[model samples]
Target: MESSSHQDSVDSTPVSYESSQHSQLSPSYPRAQTTSLSLSSTPVNDQAHNGYSSPATSVSPQPEEPFKAPSPAVTRKKLSGYVGFANLPNQVHRKSVRKGFQFTAMVVGESGLGKSTLINTLFSTTIKPQRLYSQPGSELPSTVSVESTSADIEENGVRLRLTVVDTPGFGDYVNNDESWKPIVDNIEARFDAYLEQENRVNRQKMVDNRVHACLYFLQPTGHSLKPIDIEFMRRLHQKVNLIPIIAKSDTMTDEEILVFKQRVLRDINYHQIQIFSAPIYDNEDEETLGENEAIASKIPFAVVGSTSLVQSAITGQEIRGRSYPWGVVEVDNEDHCDFVKLRQMLIRTHMEDLRERTNLVLYERYRTEKLLGMGVAQDPTVFKEINPAAKMAEERTLHEAKLSKMEAEMKMVFQQKVQEKEAKLKQSEEELYARHKEMKDALEKQRLELEEKKRRVESGRPLTPDRPSVGQQQSQKKRFGLGK
Candidate 1:
């Protein structure tokens, strides 16, 4: 009676009333259609309610939609105020300044070509001191050797680590056939060092020892390039940045220097030897473009280097140049020679460009060849970019193909099972039919015998006359004494 009364009270309460009560308790919460709310006035009685029936109410949950990723199209946004990210250049500048910079330069030429003087003049420092020749009757070095010098220089809070590689005794031998081999081997050795560092597990302290520029000093002979010059440039051009310089240009007149530069360029072009030139960009300003163009126009620069300052012939002002009886030739004067242009391109403007070209072009080419020679290959798709949509589509296609194959296999198995079942049922039906026919034939034969016996009884004929019984045959044998 108590259970009946409790069920009656529950049925009297409407769902709307319960939902209103829940909303009054928690008004901000949203009520979903599939949500169930139950209220019990007392404890559940397990004995009163059958175990099959639950006391709580439950609602089936609706299936939710699958999540989709956002589109990959880039969206540009405009900011109203200056953000700190705009100062990224300043941050990088501070970091780079704090870390400092490093650069390596190589100079290759024969002895007494003023290579040491030119290097000292270029950097405005005694990086390579003047070498003292051996005394008379001393034996000379039979082979060329490479020498390197390093210095740390700082100016206005910025520091630079400069390395200069010098090739002495080059082109000094009587048979200078293999003079360039040592220089080439040294450059390759630097490249190998850098490659080894890159392959190391800890690369945070990796150093860049690769050659960035090669300054090949040319003899001021007032003629075309020699076979040795052409051969050296041709062999070393691919390995490093080649900057051909006409050494000791004060020895030749202006007309002769001009004619010699043309002839040297002709020979270089004829031999297809590449030389480093300043690169111009489309977005550069007019001043920069003009400056780069002027720099490029003075390729194969004719230069003179001197540490001592001399007075100018016209201005009477002290300048860096050579003192001559006829007139003073200023090293910093564009009218005198191409020294100022060479310095501008090499140090003031294109130093970073040289480093970039070496790392991205020259070093990369050498590394590729080295790796290929060592049988190291890279997959073409290793660093390839992937599109999310395209990748998803490809995966979906593969999944659909797999599903199709599985479905075909299932259908084939089902058909085979159905065929086997049909064959078994057909065999069973044939066997049942044969058993029924045999039973019918036996029943018909029994019915005919019964009719014949009834006919024999009605006609009053002796049933025993058709076939004698075994008891009657035994009695006749005993009577005739033939039973034994």
Candidate 2:
């Protein structure tokens, strides 16, 4: 069985880590994405595989004083780019609680699926999105995936100091998205430093200061949670608190909405997930349609207009605008709802319960045959078999070794991912160069044609801006009295 601490680390990926919506789905979420101690990717079928995470080294770049600005470092080294999560504070060890809590989250999804737009809309930040492309010839996805974004956001009486994570677009490229294995592989390739054993839990920073919850922003649509979403939620199941949100609920209908709910809940049951969703108001206007030919071509639809219908039923008097019958009054004027209640349920109610469960059931409880997957917290006597001091020392060593190995393995894994990305970027650069060359060549051909016309004009030969067929050219010359 995996250790609890590692589970804790993985769970934190959303709060401090994140995921959300899109129209695409992958056949499987990558094995590397799962929070495990081992880092190697060459796994046999029998051995369990989650996705992979690269190693992370603490970076404390000293900021220059106000008078002096800093220079960005340029290196021809392996690119283990850290997406989603924010940097650890400089004096994190020194606990001086400040004003306003840092509420972090990672945004993930396909390239054009509004992941970045959602972040900008939510936090009101001006984040320039990077273009995501595909790999050449092999028909595979671009190695430079739309990974998690590492950014802070704030808005609307909600000073949510958040980290919007941007992930690689799943089905953006041409590779058969047989459940998008490569996309998940990229997530599994994120930095995995907390789960390392020898790595002493920065109990303060990690346990108390890590991610509080994960908000999975699903795009509003008629389609339900695709297999890819199921795989994603399943993998991140134990790692963090998940709040499933519908981004654009306007496109769904009464029947489709019911199906989407039933399907998601069914998947939740199948996974045996206890701590689950608290519904939030649909943030986007469902009526807003996409302009892209690919998206605009789909059937135009509207959200179920029951707001007024429900409102009339409630007040004994005829009401106008949106309403519902289930007493699901979205009290906050067309805009806000009781997210406070939902927030409490997410960050408070089930929090301590899950925390305890994670530590007791998932963490302290060992399941290596000795306990046979039973709860290990039942008896205190289990600790008696080994010497207290020696056991502590051994545990520390093992933990350290686990940490070191995890570091080395994660570093290697993410580096491979980075190299894959760099190679992709290099290829894209080459393609762009070729495209520029082609455009230049075409422009030259057009230029030569114009030059020939100018030369004819100077020599008193028949000339015109447009090229004409033989019959038309002769007719024009005859009309102009130019046929000698």
Candidate 3:
């Protein structure tokens, strides 16, 4: 009985061990199998002998399953929480503010057109000092001279480097035929300087002294553009952003200004001069579109520039304008002048646009022409942006055309070879046919001669010619009477 009980216990131990091993091999029963193996390794009699509780009684029957890995095909997911990446505009704004900005503007017109005053009024600061003419007896300058003034201004912690280029003695001469030459030369010189800097090895500290915008102040003649104005603009329009302004517009009535603007525009159109206008974009809001339109409607802006403060009679407010006996012309008043609109477009709205156009359009054109003059040629496709799909299609088309050309050449060669072979074969066939016909005719003539010989033999005729040769010849000679 004791041996049988021992045998039964041994058999039960192997069964439990095998079950634990099987459970350990299965993925879903890892933890439960580990616990069962640990508990089963201890003997039950040893636990009772040591007065210790069996660990199997405390073990759980089932254990939680392990986590499975996600599927490889799963890509998109609905995020339950936020992850921040929406501050790009703020970052750009901060960087731009840290870098600051720079702008260069050129003012071109005749003397006493209030160019200096207009620049001062635009920036709300004294940019160019008032120029004092020489005494009445002193000689004036023979030609136009370019004057440049620079200032660093700051508004709300944003710093700006502003440069104003003034052209003096432009139309003051009686023979102002070459007045635009000096200004044009100066602008080209700036472009050359920039190109030189670009060609240098180290361009880190390059200065941008290129003139971006040119404000051409038109005289309030209540007529059309002057000859000098037309010539100057025609020369400089391609090099700079041309902004036309009517100086001292307060002198002309609103009706006169309107008619004068029309005449000036007509002249500009007739001369094929390009003036700077605000660019309209499709994505702009309605307000921006309307604002741009309003600004454009006031082109060739008629303006009155005054730095003096005058109290308005109606508003009882001090405004930057000139006081007159009859009425005051406010510089910031839109109804009185287009000074505010001009300032808005120049400084507030289209400042960057002006710089961009100058660099991209005007400067690039000049650079291209200069390089071409210097014998430096460039491929038209260089630095040009191309769409990948279009490029692929173009390559495919070229490949197809090339294949077609090769196929055509191959077909032409094959046809020529075939024709030559046919001609050779025909010649050989004709030669064989002619040789066979000649052999056949020889055989037929031989047969005819044999048949005649056989027929003569059958009829007992002489086989050889009855030429008793010498005797027959002598007899014939005698009969002919002189052969001897």
Model 3, span 289-316: residue lDDT tens:
8987788778789999988889997898
Candidates 1 and 2 compared by TM-score, better number = 1
Candidate 1 structure quality by residue, lDDT tens digits, 216-322: 99999876677788889989988888888999999999877776666666556556666777776668899988997787767789999887789988899887788
Q: Look at candidate 1 and tell me the lDDT of residue 415.
A: 100
TM-score of 3: 0.64
Please count the clashing residue pairs in each candidate, in the order shown.
0, 49, 0
Question: Which consecutive 10 residues in model 1 have the weakest lDDT in total?
Answer: 23-32
- Which prediction has more favorable lDDT, 2 or 3? 3
Please provide TM-scores, in order, for all candidate models, with all chains considered together: 0.64, 0.36, 0.64
Per the 3 Å backbone cut-off, how many clashing residue pairs does candidate 1 have? 0
> lDDT tens string, model 2, 54-134?
122212234354322245587886559865335445344223233333433444444444445434322223342535555
